[model samples]
Structures are given as structure tokens and as C-alpha cells.
Target chain A: MVCIRFLKALQSVLDSRITVLYETHKGLGARFVDFAGWRMPVLYSGVVEEHMAVREACGIFDVSHMGEIEVSGPGAEAAVQYIASNDIERIVDGQCQYTLVCNDTGGVIDDTIVYRRSADNFLFCTNAINTDSVFCWLLEKLHGREGVEVIDRSGEYAQIAIQGPASLDIFKIAFGIDTEEIRPFRFIETTVAGSLAIVSKTGYTGEQGLEIYLAPASAPAAWDALMAAGAGHGIKPIGLGARDTLRLEMGYPLYGYEITEEFGPIEAGLKRFVALEKGGFIGQKAMVERAEGAPKSVLVGLRMEGSGVPRTGYELFSGDKAAGNVTSGTHSPALKYGVAMAYVAPEFKEPGTRLNMQIRKRSVECTVVAIPFYRREKK
Target chain B: MEFPEDLKYSKEHEWVRLEGDTAVIGITDYAQDSLGDVVYVELPAEGDAVTRGETFGVVESVKAVSDLYSPVSGSVVEMNDAVVDGPEAINEDPYTEAWMLKIELDNIEELEELLSADEYQQFIEEEK
Candidate 1:
């Protein structure tokens, strides 16, 4: 009896609200890790190999762990505009915008993509771990408001991202998408694998890519059709590990790593996403004050002059004085050197400023450079 | 996946080959496989001392960082500059070409504590 109970408990511990791609990962030499309570594949072959595959050709990502919240009602527009940092009024029907949900103190609560389904309906694509908190925050804020309805639809849907240089062609061949018409940051609903799905033109890679949102039950068929369609197109399945490096190479901010509750958009080099003139948003005044340009520190990119890959929380120095610390870093496969994104003092954020990072207790010289160490070519 | 018959292995996945007063050390194939593609490796300079079960160096993949521990106490006599410069070689041939260092042993008796090839294989099996 005790052994049976132990086995049952062990089964629960192992099973983590598995994604639709869970079975597919097992056949692909995937190594799994527990991330935010989800058993996520950290890699298939290796981080560098997968990184290069996406850079040279194309890559597919199972971003099903991301959450969704559907908001619709008479007062939905006012509620959304009051909640997010970006001006949702700017996004019309069939469009999406990357924005931040900030606290009253101008700190980032969560970063999300707002998909405008219609004038009064929007779906929020939230980070996996922050889904519950964002939903709760929304409910609490919209308590007295009568006309707006916010529903947490995170568990109902799954998401996928196809990224790289060859993404558009692969998407066209696989899904019959007419890429010549779809503008960036726009989305359209269509049938994929005999199921309803929302195909969007926004991506995190700084490359032209598309995001697909569909129901969980039909996600398997959709993924299978996609894999079969793109099998001969040099499309490799990417994992969270490579996804991290690819985004870091572009200096895109990861929520917990670069922008958190302790820092504002201005400090994380995302001021453009914040619409200061559009008042009535949460943290509007504090964001306006920050826009005055008196932030204590700013995000900057650092390339190691010496060897040694910098990791998160490593100390950074400018000459003899203590500077800042690395937030996210890796040995960039494309750049052929270690690249890091750090929040350093304003004086040390210049393009050519030389700094030092202590890797494994040894100080190594690094030079501050611009974000996006890699840029995709325009077609 | 290959564990040589003559080399002694540690639970931390380091393999050591004893030759007279000198000992050669590197990560086992199991270790290299688990670490994935190694992007960077940090090694102690020549003439530095290392103690048994202590961290002597670090190997970093694009995702994670792992400490390379010394299985036997010794003073480092030489370092593999090749693996330091291009760490992917360790993934290619962890036992031979990827050998991390050659140390002059301070206490050769420490070899008795290490597992034999068969025992190490069993240990890896048990871990799995």
C-alpha cells in the first residue's frame, strides 16, 4: 500500500500540466527541465547548435506555457487603456502591440502582447508565470467597473512561434499564409489543421516570424501538420535555452531577468513602449517623471574583451569603481564572443565605455556597446 | 558513453588516469553529454594547487555553468589550452583530446577511493 502511494505521488510530481508538444519532444533527444512548474524542454541537441539553426534557417518553438486573458465588454477599451503602459487605442482591429503592465509606482508588473480582436475585445498574451498575478491584478482593478468583463483564458489555449530568416517562406508553404499582405504586429484568424487559430506577425527574435494561438485539444494536430510541412525546409525545433540566447543576442528583455517589479521601463530601455502623453494609465505620472530622464541607471550591452562567458548576477566594474551587474548573458553564437545585457550607471552606458565583469571571481575587461548585437537582413 | 577500463572515475563524473607521479584528468563522457555543447571553459593556470573534491575550473554551456572538480589532490603542472580556446572539443572527445589537465600528484593514495570502470558504469546506471 505504501509503495503504491509512493508511486502515485511520484507520478504527480513528474507530470506537469504537459504541453501539446510533450510527446514530440521525447523523440527529438530533448532534455527537460522544470521551469515555472512546467516541464519544459531546455534543449534538443545543444544550445549552440539550435541557436545556429534558427539564425541560419528557421526554428519552431512550443510557447504553449504562455497565458491568455480575454477581455470584452462595453467598457473594455477604457479598462485596457487604463491597465497597460502602451496606448491600446493605437491598435485597431486585427492588430497586436507589445506593452507592459506597470504598478502604481512605475514598476513593471508584467510584459505582454495585446491582441486587438475587435474594438471592444482584446486578448492579452501573458508570460507563463505571471498569468495568475496579471489576472488577479485585472480583477482587482476592474472591481467597481460594471460594463467590462475580464476572463482568464490561459488554460484554454496554446501558442507557437516560428522564427528565423526562412520563417515567412516556411509559414507560407505550411499554412498557406499570404505573407505579402500581413503587416508586422498584425494578426488574422484562420483554420490550421482543421482547427481555429490566430496567426500573428509579431515575434521576439528581431526577425520576421509569426505566432499561432489555438486551443489545447487541437494543438497536437496543428503541431504535427506544421512539423510535417516544414520537415524539408531546414526547420529545427527550438527550446527555451536557445530561445533565451536568441532574445538576449537581440537585447530583448526577459521579464524576471531584465525588467522586474524593482525597475521601470525607462531603466530597462523600453521607454518607447510607454505612451506618456496618453494619460489615465496606471503609473502614468511616475512614468512621465521617469521620462524626464533622471533614471538612476540604464540598460546597456557588454562584449567581453577577454574570454569567459558572463552569467546572471555577475558583478560589473568600470575601471576602479563599482559599476553594475549583468542581468542576462551568454557566449553569443553569432557574435563569436561573450555578450551581456546589464544595467549600469548612466555614466558607463555609453557605446564605447569600457567596463569589467567578474566571471567566476576573476575580473575581465568588457566594452559597452549598443543593444541587438545581431540584426537580421532586410529582404 | 565510453568508460575506459584503466581509468578511475568519480561520482561527479571526472575520470583520472594515474601515471607514475602524474595524473591526467577530464570530464567523463557522461559528464560531457549531460553538459551539452560546451561554449567556454575556465582552467587554473599552471603551478596552481588543487585539492580532492574541490572546484578547480568551470565549464559553461550556453544555458548552464558547471564546476569541474578535482578527483585527486595535486599541483597543476599543465593545462590544455586547446579546450580552453575551443570547448566544443570536449564534447567531441571527452576522454582523450578533451583532457583538462595533467597534475603532479601530492597524494597518489587518493586513487584508492575512486571507483573502478565497472563500478563507475554501475554508478551511472543507478543514477539513471
Candidate 2:
């Protein structure tokens, strides 16, 4: 309900432009689906084909859809630390940390990335739907904190992700920078194709890639620059369909689908983001207590023992009892098997523990498996 | 999108290629395209009875799974093992090799209630 209210408020304030791919999507026979209220490309050639392309070579994505916020002035780090689950103090400048913003009750507001640009400046990268919520939350948190400024810069920046093994080479030529020096979770404010861009060595695809954040008007130019530089490397433009599969293959959680407000960060297998030792965050005490106790359910990976593929919202069973339900599942092109992530009863979370997933009304056999069903070879 | 002129079509995008009392059932190219990607297909076992307009199987995509309904009352004579093993065949070539099952019909008259290629195309256009 907060998201709905926030979206209504945002509509009154922001004017978002749909990208050119919206038209190109229809041309490529893409089944356009509404994602976070934007008409997005779900599939182009196909999800499976696009998913395989990212695993094999390079798959470009118009992630311009993700929300961007800039926090400047002194006390920006404290403002983020007081609101986010991860310890902001631990993160060094030019580095990014995956963190969760939580409600007072320990429920997830959203999972976000905090990019520490400097002691006084920071950028919070978040999901498209939760931009308003994150902005409001930070604005309220920093109300009396002098010298701190929270600005919703979502309308200004466009995000593009070139994901796969060939991404580093693609970044090197497009930006004329030695991208090999950039480590994971690190970023550099550099010019690419004559446009100011923040190139970050981070992605959800479990591949070596850079997510370029630049001006919205310059996005098409940046995309063209990448495609031109990467044409020889077998890079192809990918849609959201491939992005989901690639992330699912790596066991990366997607907001609204895998993680939701009804669940806390610890239960969602994101305990790493919960800074229990840190003092006085919105959900700190509740999360700390939960960490010491047992979770009602723990997220685990499941594979169908037979042939059928498990899907989101499909019930997971232990004997005749409804133990859990699937959150994300896919037919991994690399594994050549059906893989899924589900929050089952704690007893069922052990690796190799046998379980059942209701495909239709039938109880199909399954087993808990290790996550990242397909891990690409390290670069 | 291929909608065979000789076949009977359902609003749900199923197609029935009839030859006397026998019928070959599969999803149409329109169905495959709408489904986005065919990751898995669950078909009824041979000898299983299917009622007209009842769900006979399911086709799963990365985003969603849709129930496949039978257009005619029939007994499953043979399930397409190839489509089961390689569900992507329906995405690659939906019209021919991706047929779901071969059925022995109980009521051939049910085919009369379904749409032809032109009618199905019109039905799809109206749906959009």
C-alpha cells in the first residue's frame, strides 16, 4: 500500500520517458509485459535463447529502468547507515555494498546498493518501484541532519548493463579505460562515448560486466557505443526476459518476486546485508534478535527430481504438510535442469534434503540443491 | 503465426489436426509466441481420457505457465515424446514437430464447434 501511495505521488511529480526499445521490442516480436509499471521487453528471440547468450558471450540490457538517487553534503554516510541494514562505515569510497532497507518491524523496504563516491557524496541504486519509498525514507531520516541533502536523481540517469564474459573487453574499448583494474563492487566516474558515466564492475548476471549510469538523453548513444565496440565480440541486445533467467541462474534475488515486504532480510538468505553489530537502524534490534533465534523458514534451492519445472508461487511440501512455496525457478540453460529457490521450513533447508513441489495439483519429487545452479568460470 | 487451414482451433490457442476418428493436438504458433519460451511441457499419458474444453496439460515459460486445454473429447493415444524432452521445439518450430499428442477421438462432432484458420485468426485479433 505504501508503494501504491508512493507511486501515485511520484506520478504527480516525475515525468518518465519510455525508451526507444519499447518500440523496437514490438518489432522483434517481444511480448511486452508491464514490469514496475513500465512496458518492458519480456522476450525478443526467446528467454531461453537470450539467457544462453549471456552465459556464452555477451547480452546487453536496457536497465535504464532502475532508480537512481544521489546523497550529497556531509552526514550522507550516517544518514545511509542509519537507514540501511549493512554497515555503511565498513564500505570504502568508490566501492558498492549490497544492503537492505527495512521497516521498523524488520520487514524489507527494499534491497539496494549503496555506492560510496566520497565521504560526503553517495549514490543509492534501487529498484524502479521502490524509488519513491527509498527517497521518502531517506528524506525523513535526514530531516534535522544539517548539511545532508537527499535528491531523487532517477529522472536524470539511465542505466545500461552489458553482461557476460566479454563485458570487460567491451568496456575497455568503449570507455578507453583499463577496466581490468576495476574490481567487483568498485566503480569509476569516467567518460564513455563523450558522455559522463559511472561505470561499476557489478551485475546480477554472475558475469564480469559494467553497469553504466549516465544521462538519460545519452543512453541511446551509450548503447550504440557499446554495440559498436562489442559487435565483434558477439554481443547482442537482451531484454528483461534474459536478465531474469541470468539472475535466477546465479540465485540472485529479485524484489517483488523472490523477496518481498512480508519477509525480512535474514529469512530471504541475505543475512550478509544485516548489520547486527551496528547500533540503531530502523530494523536493527528485531534483525539482531532474529539472527540469534531460528527463522520460521529459510530460503533454499530446489531441483525437480523428475522432469516438470517448478515455478513461482508453486507450493512446496514435506510429506502432506505445506511447508513452503517457490519464489523463483527456471530451466537453467547451462545446467540443462530445472532449478529453483524456495523458502521452506528450516528442517527442509539442508542441502540434498528431499522435498516435493506441487506442479499443478500433483506432488512432484524434488531435492534441495546448492545455489548458483550455474557458476561461470572466474575471470 | 501458423494456423493450419485444415485444423480446428480453440480460443485458448490449441489446434486439432483431424483425420477421420484420430486427431493430432498441439499448440498453435500464436500460442507458442504468446507463451514467450517453452521450458517444459506436461502432457497426459497415453490411454488417459480427456474431456472437451478441459485442461489436458501445461506449458511452462520462464515468466508464467499456462494450461493447455483439449479441443475435442478423446483418449490420448500417443504423447509427443520429442516435445516433452525438448519443449523448445515448440518455440523453434511450433506448427509441425512440436505437436503435443496424438489422440483417438470419442466424439468427432466436437471438432465442428471449433474455429478454422481464418476464424481463429479473427478470434485472436478480437482478443488483442
Candidate 3:
């Protein structure tokens, strides 16, 4: 009876999930919040300050909450190509492709990055909340199929992303590896902080950066090493609050917000990722049919002309007619103005087209603008 | 979080400073600290009627939005334009510089219902 009561007390105390770097975050003065059933840091110094740090200098993020799934065997290539919307064959070893996992109805299951490891090995980095569903979907789809195995490796690795213009220098100082030759969407497998890790030249922020995946046990040491090395370059510990703002400034689609099971990739303006000509893939037929028909709503970027921030689910209007609604919206720290991504009628999709966004009870004027609201200039 | 002795606090985390018939209102330091880096603020215009315990405006942080409730019901005499232009000031000094509105008090007795500095501190402790 004592043991059972103690176990129940322990279970109650450990209700919420936490990542491997939760202690590290708490030590850095992170503000904790309940995110997708996980106790994650929402901010440290501040959202705007950390956001500017990533844009101007360097910032590190704990992305261990992101899910990782491995598919390996002789049939891995065939299975991946059938499920993913992107052409997995296009990426060689050491290359990653931004792709979408779709259901049979052509709705997005999760937007993911597929890394080609070898001829029969591939890894998928999925959204944190959709990890289990994605893993189950992959298993159910590939059930009874020979020679392919799906394994969830989410708990095996801790992911860290270092972003900004100064990330390359910090990475070199910390890892002693030259990443100048590694192009975007490419990764290299090597030892980082005495542990095998995969360093990829990819990030959600529209800045030059690298995402490192390594063993969870080695993450704290690796994070400390990077922080020490990056101290000279002004690297701030970024939190998920700044992460959302950074990605929002780039008009990147968040899983639950911009891409959902109700909307298809074509309507979400991700038709390029869907390989329509390459038939036999799941959702290809429905996606192709969607591509042919006139879309009911199209996702477009909105720049606020009036005061007030546009929030998700806010109704949008073209003159007096109800057009659509906002999916993801934020006050852009980089632009110093409110910006949003909304799904609107096709007629109101053109840049400079005027629209009214209902923020609370007030109707705020906004204009349709081209996406990628803030793009870093290349040297 | 610093709660001023002269200012009365509401259960909704708003502070009110009674100046004769005028009541200056703003979010408390505890409220601003909890909100974290306020990005935008929406305030009712001057001459707008406000009711006690009702949402008079909104304060938006990077990740969340919080409603600012009225401590005492009255007519808005003035709304702070400086705070509206730069919402981050709330995080810097929520009490003085970020005062949201000055209202002509409808009932001075309403201030009696608010918590004192010591009471507000105890309330926040219990809240935590």
C-alpha cells in the first residue's frame, strides 16, 4: 500500500512531459509554459530581444521536443516516396528535402524534413505534437510490407538549432568543423562534442544557421560548449516565443496553424512540394484534382495598414464580402509592424489588394503582400 | 513585483491610483511580468464608458493575449498614447509610464473594495 501510494504521488508530480534540456533552460531563466503536453520554455531574456539576436547575431534553440522517425531497409525508398509529397529520389545522401506527409484525402498530416541517410535509410523530423500520429500513420500504411521498418527515435536524440549570421563562426569555434562548403538543405555526419551527430544547414528562421542532432546524454555538454564559444559573438538562448515570431516573419507555416487536416497542400500554397506528375504516391490523385479545380481559398500574407495585431481565426473581408480568415498572425519584431498569414479567396490573393481584418470588434485595414515578409540579404 | 502602497489593486491584476475624482489605471507590475514583453496594447478612446470588472482593453504579449479589466467603472477622461505607440514600456514600468487610462470616477466607494499593497501581495502569493 505504501509503494502504490508513493508511485501515485510520483506520477502526479510528473504529469507534464519535459525535454532533456529542461533543466538547462530553467537555469538560463526560461519562462515555462505548457506546450503540446510538454513543459517548454516560452522565453528567456525577452521575445523581441532574442528575435533580434537571431537576426543580427546568433541564437541557440532547444528543439529536442521535435520528433524523429527512422525508416530503414530495402523498401525504405519505395515506402518514403509513396507517403511523402516531395520527390525523395531527388535528394542524395547527406541531403534533406522539405516535404509534407499527406493523408489519402490530400490533407496535410504534418510538414516534415526528410533526410536521406543512404540507399535504404531515411530519417524524418516531424512536428512535436504530430509525432505519435505520424509514426502510427507510417506504421499503418506500411503494415504487412516486407523489408521496411519504421522506428520512432524521438527520445534517442536531442536537437539544437544555432541561427544567425554569426552561426558559422560559432559552429566552427565550438565543433572545430568548417561548414562553409555545406550548402543549404545538406548535412554532414560527424563527431560533435565527443558524440556522433548530424549537423544540417537548415532552420525555420530566414537566417544562415545549422541544426544539430546528437545523443540526448551529450546535449547539455554540447549546449554549454556552444554557449561558451558563442559568448564572444553575442549568442542568446532563444525560446519558443521568439522561435514562433522568427518563423512568422518568414511566413513559414506552423503545423497546427497554417497546415491542418482540413486544408490541402495546394490551397496552402505548397503545391511545389507535391509531385503531381510522379503518380502512385498517396494523395497524388486528390492533389492533382485540387490543382486542376479552382481553389476555394488561398493562403496569402497580410501586412497591417492599421493598428492592432491580427490573431488566428479572425475574419477577413474584401470590401463587404467575407473572404476568409487568418491562420497565423503576429507583430513582426523585424518589420516593426503587424503581419499575418491568412487564407483568402483567390481574387484577393494578389499583392497590394486591400482587405479588412476584424481584430476583436474593430475592423483593421490590411493589404495582401508577398510572403517571406523578411528575407536576409546574401553577401 | 512592486505594488505601490498608494495604488489600489484589483483581483484582475489592474492597479488604480485615486487622484480626487480622477482614477489613473494601468496593469500592475505583477501583471506585466506575467505577460512577458508586451508587443501591443489596445485601449478604449477618451469619453468611452467603462464598467467595473469588465474588459476595457487588451494587452498582447508575443505568445498570448490578456484582457485588461477596469478597477472602477467611469468615463475615460484620457487614454495614454505613448503606451499605445510603444507597448514594451509596460514591461519596463507598468505603474508610472505605462498608465493606460484616466477615468472620471463614477463611484469612489468602488476603490474601497480593492486590495491594499499588503493585501495585493498576499493575493499574489496565494495566486502563485
Top candidate by lDDT? 3
lDDT of 2 at A90: 89
Clashes of each: 0, 0, 0
lDDT of 3 by residue, B1-128 (tens): 68888999999999999888999999999998888878889999999999999999999987788998999999999999999999999999999999999999989999999999999999999998
TM-score of 2: 0.93
Model 1 whole-model lDDT (C-alpha atoms): 0.88
Docking class of 3: medium
**Residues A49-88 of candidate 2: C-alpha lDDT, one tens digit per residue:** 7887788778888877788888888888878888889998
Poorly placed runs, candidate 3 (over 4 Å): A1-14
lDDT tens digits, residues A283-308, model 3? 88889888999989999999999988
- Tens-digit lDDT string for candidate 1 (B6-99): 9999999999998778999999999998988788899999999999999999998877899988999989999999999889999999989999
Order of the predicted models by DockQ, top scorer first: 1, 2, 3
Model 3 TM-score? 0.95
Tell me the deviation in Å of residue A318 in model 2: 2.2
